[model samples]
Target: MTDKAQKPSTRLIAVTLDEASIGHSTPDIEHERATAIWDLVEDNAFFPCGDPGTGPYALHISLMDNRLVFDIKREAGEQVVQHHLSLTPFRKVVKDYFLVCESYYAAIRTASPSQIEAIDMGRRGLHNEGSELLRERLKDKVEVDFDTARRLFTLVCALHWKG
Candidate 1:
């Protein structure tokens, strides 16, 4: 078996978050958004469904009319498909995720290792749920693995805070 690392042809070369849509975020929220985008660009498999031309894409995420918009384009800026997903489906999970995250952040300083671990575990669980939902919601529009979905989910949450 060849141990060659396969190059990801269908991956995001750039990601943009609408600053106006993401108004007045806390430092923590801003950091989370940056990290998620960085991770997604560094390593991800984001293939646009159907025929949207070839590899290497750029993604612009924004919120419009309480819907999440994914404006995809070619690396050189050719227009591709645009998808708008309603935020209603993600409300509960995102809310819970934020609550758990708050607890986990609070636990980091004062709680015991076990306590912190437990809170982090719950936080991860919520994250996974959000990721799964994102994958399911975008299944028809975009094809993304669990990891990619997770990072995308973080971006979703980032947009959701203002929505």
Candidate 2:
């Protein structure tokens, strides 16, 4: 076995996530329950939008990582879905990635797995080219397993994206 060096410090610990690790893809029941719990523990919030164009977002159930984000798209018949979200897995103390992921798993317990579609925008202005860039920035942070982060994101969305 190869020996690994211990990290000297975790001050730079910052939780991060990608579009693929969210909670809305789950069933309404599960998502609602998760979001309900989240609403009980948030300060401020907002709905995520425009892939955030590589910037901040709104969170309802605030954890760690002072950043926020959301995915946005216009659906058929003038409906728009802005998938807002939040995370807490940049371990300055301990590894919390799994814990955060657990929340996602719990929320998605009753839902079917789905795929995120590419956002199409030729009518209004919804730039979506920074996805890879955002993903790259989020690489070093934690991840949301089984839609756990969605419940957390619900907190942000409900509160209109506040910390």
Candidate 3:
């Protein structure tokens, strides 16, 4: 029997965002999308449960039928898992996140340093909440560290953005 240690660790090597689904997003949203993908590729722990294949995975994130889809594949392009999660649970949080982000950005322009910091803190809190919700939603389907989930949540939010 092969020892567990002999198996390759599961991690994401590349990530793609589906443009067709997302349409045209704001520059801020685009930046967030790019940054999240970059951060996720640079460092992440991603393991698809019930899949025996060891992987440096490639992920394609998109929205379809109001669901968030994770199209996962091995580095070699062989498909591993495709999981679709309902967006219903994320709607309120995403909306709230966007609102808080807008406030934070506006605050950065004119609010006092203390005010900006306070807004920033609230923004981060909402972001963390969204990430935690994402982790919970994916618990049965995938195993991911908090940071990975946070980055993934960003991408998910980008996809969820209407404008």
lDDT of 3: 0.86
lDDT by residue (41-112, candidate 3, tens digit) is 887888888878578789999889988999999898999989999999999999999999889989989999
Q: RMSD in Å for candidate 2, one decimal?
A: 18.1
Error of 2 at 39 (Å): 10
| Best of the two (1, 2) by lDDT | 1
Score residue 142 of candidate 3 by CA lDDT.
87
Give TM per candidate: 0.91, 0.21, 0.91
**Where is model 3 poorest over a 10-residue stretch in terms of lDDT?**
1-10
Better of 1 and 2 by TM-score: 1
The runs of at least 3 residues in candidate 2 whose Cα sits more than 4 Å from the true structure, single-residue gaps closed, are 1-35, 38-138, 161-163
Worst 10 residues of 1 by lDDT: 1-10
Q: In model 1, which residue pairs have backbone atoms overlapping below 3 Å? A: none
Give all candidates' CA lDDT scores: 0.85, 0.29, 0.86
